[model samples]
Target: MAIKYGRPIELREISRRDGATASPALDLTVRPRRNRKAEWARRMVRENVLTTDDLIWPLFLIDGNGKREQIASMPGVDRLSVDQAVREAERAMKLTIPCIALFPYTDPSLRDEEGTEATNPDNLVCRTVRAIKKEFPDLGILCDVALDPFTSHGHDGLIADGKILNDETVAVLVRQALVQAEAGCDIIAPSDMMDGRVAAIREGLDRTGLLDVQIMAYAAKYASAFYGPFRDAIGSAKTLTGDKRTYQMDSANSDEALREVELDISEGADMVMVKPGMPYLDVVRRVKDTFAMPTFAYQVSGEYAMIAAAAGNGWLDGDRAMMESLLAFKRAGADGVLSYFAPKAAEQLKAQG
Candidate 1:
């Protein structure tokens, strides 16, 4: 509707005589857009900032000599042997990356139904941790304390009669944490999503006098289809015969994620992470706001692959897209991001700086 003053109106004036009492003020006082006019101005007004310091590189370790195996699903990502992994960690150290997360590609021969190899002090994961610490003692080492990578069945925990046993899984996880801690891991990230695992790990660590190790819980990991590429990278795709919906959080629930985070925090998680970063920015924001802890987001395999595939086809600029995607995590209030593109992104950021 149009009013007499030429302004569109949603409500009608009850009486024409009432116009006398109504005064129109046309003061050009506020100009908020002016501050957003220039690059420097926009930067000054920016609410959230992202930096190279906010990145944590995730590396895959394998058992071999002079190996650099490429993961086809995850472009530009490779699985390196322990020596090569240490060299990559050295590069990250020079680039000033605060941390590096290690995920081992367990050989099929080593994986068992119970994932008992996970508790071995000289397992692939523990050996990699020890090697990284020996070479780069000052650098942060985050180990994934989950059994999927080591389990023949490819479930995060022990499965019996078509169901996951929570209490039984926590017991093994405690032993897994102790082994990782003994191998000089700085942080133990329990990505299994098993109930009471964090508390079990905490108690296990304390009893063993490894109380200094930190726990970064994958508190709200969902059973999303986005993990297909990751499964391919870790060679677990063929082993996982069924879905993880019984244990992992449902993709449809947002409030439930907050409750899960709360429980992990109470159970002694030093930090919490929300998986599949791009799809769950809202979850990241909510968790950061609600807990006010060192919240992190995982720029999972699918997020990495999509950008790379598009860039490879000349549909998008790879470097620009990579930086933009990383910056989004920072804008969403992530203290750190676990990304496969960390090295590439960090190199570019260093060059730009």
Candidate 2:
């Protein structure tokens, strides 16, 4: 049965008269796809933009000279020698990368339980810093103030009686920051995840008349599984006795990361960062939104491995994926990203401009 002229009619008479005031089912007033129809329109309406200035390259340092030995887990990363590191810094300048973070691979003979090599005024990191500063005096150099690279047991803090020591370990980290500052390191990044270390490092630097050196605190570093290849690069994976869950942030908590960031900022950190970036992007966004400070994120080793591995195997276009990932950090409110793909991404951005 059908309705014709506002009355019931037989099925045979349905097409004979008007059944209804026919109209289209949907009357759409707004179409979002209009803006997405052209590349120029999409670019004009982009919410966030990523540029070469938003990248910080991390360079691993080794003991010898002229060696560029690659790590097995990390696809393209290598431990560069001091002279080679200087050349790389020059390359970074050419690429317009504002900063290059240095991580040293200390010799096994130098590592000990107390991580005393960290305080040596002439260690690998200090030497490399001096070398780079000599050639590229204006390029910002950031040194990590964690003991794991120099500790025999592969922990970021001093250990005593099967426990990670806090206050005592902070004393050593203070000296480590002092030495790096004295060696012309512009920023001291305390990735040790120890309580009150940022305040201690800041005080120590000021006492030594190095008032201009900045402190970039790894405020929300988590004991994440993504650090395996990073530990391998820094020669810590082999000797690591236990996990760092005691000090590093718990993955189960988001508010705790905000608390950690708050504490570090109160303690005199010039900048704050959330480690193992992609998984903790919400934390990154929270920290940035809450404090409105200079916030950074570390695109950790495992994230790099996943992208590089997939790209190497012809599973994806590496360049586009890398750009999209970095842009995601920007979308998450990161001021900059410490990434292994910094150089490559910078080149791509420069090409685009």
Candidate 3:
């Protein structure tokens, strides 16, 4: 029988009704906190454990020797020269970081309307890849196959009559992939978001006899404000004329992300990525569930800066927040993450073990 309450019932009154001395008014048979009562218990029941293997350190490259130019917006992150980049790659390898993604901060003189320098074999990115491979041959090197860093207008594709051309840009992207592959890039990540580029790049790679090289397409890259710090890091913030809303996915749509991922997969992308990770974890989960393919996420620059800023102001514990953020990616079913926090997080994990 349900007891209807007109007023609050005392524990003693309930005890009297039950014919007991002092029975409690409320009882919980399941105590969810029991599993969290001890560290050992929590560890044993942890659904996801982040490790060094899940990290891919994204490094910025420039031209020089022993140079490490820091990006103001992204604290603790720097653009390194070829020699410095190789040393950074060696450090990542020592930490057991499986890979490092390279994005070049191309000089202004190299920037042009067609982004022709992207195809140059001795370009900053290609030279960095060659140097890193020479020293750390086993370390996986992911090269960003985009024109934004090389383009004067900072657009990922060619601009024609105030519009970004898709098909024409893809033709150039194919050449860019071939150049990176020729430089021994382990993965050619086309972050351009141009339609049909993956199939074109895959074909280009195959014809060039670079079959072993992989393509990790940025399938669900969104035009979000989260990319601001990244633009600053790559020195593209100043040159960008207009937004990339025409090509990049809208932040409002989730279904569209699925379609993008599906198309990329069908077009021969060996792996797919969701950019600006934390905000789109749902997209990540959905893509992983739908395809069961190798899925990765970029913990983009803005996300790192926010955490760092808060920590610097003493509002949050930096180390704890960093670990939690990375682990959240694992819990959301990310196979791996491209993070600026990679080296620091890896060191923390190593220290913990």
Candidate 3 C-alpha error for residue 138, in Å: 0.5
Ranking by TM-score: 3, 2, 1
lDDT of 2 by residue, 124-165 (tens): 999999999999998999999999999999999988899999
lDDT of 3 by residue, 60-107 (tens): 988888999989989899999999998899899899999999999999
Tens digits of lDDT, candidate 1, 192-295: 99999999999999999998999999999999988888898788999897899989999999999999999999999999999979999999999999999999
State the C-alpha lDDT per candidate. Answer: 0.91, 0.93, 0.92
Winner by lDDT: 2
Alpha-carbon runs more than 4 Å astray in model 2: 1-26
- Total backbone collisions, model 2: 0
Query: How well does model 3 score by local distance difference test?
Result: 0.92
Model 2, residue 281: distance off in Å is 0.4
What's the residue-level lDDT of 334 in candidate 1?
93
For residue 162, what is the lDDT in candidate 2? 96
Q: Candidate 3, which ten residues in sequence have the lowest lDDT sum?
A: 1-10
TM-score of candidate 3 on Cα atoms, chains taken together? 0.93
TM-score of structure candidate 1: 0.91
Clash count list over all predictions: 0, 0, 0
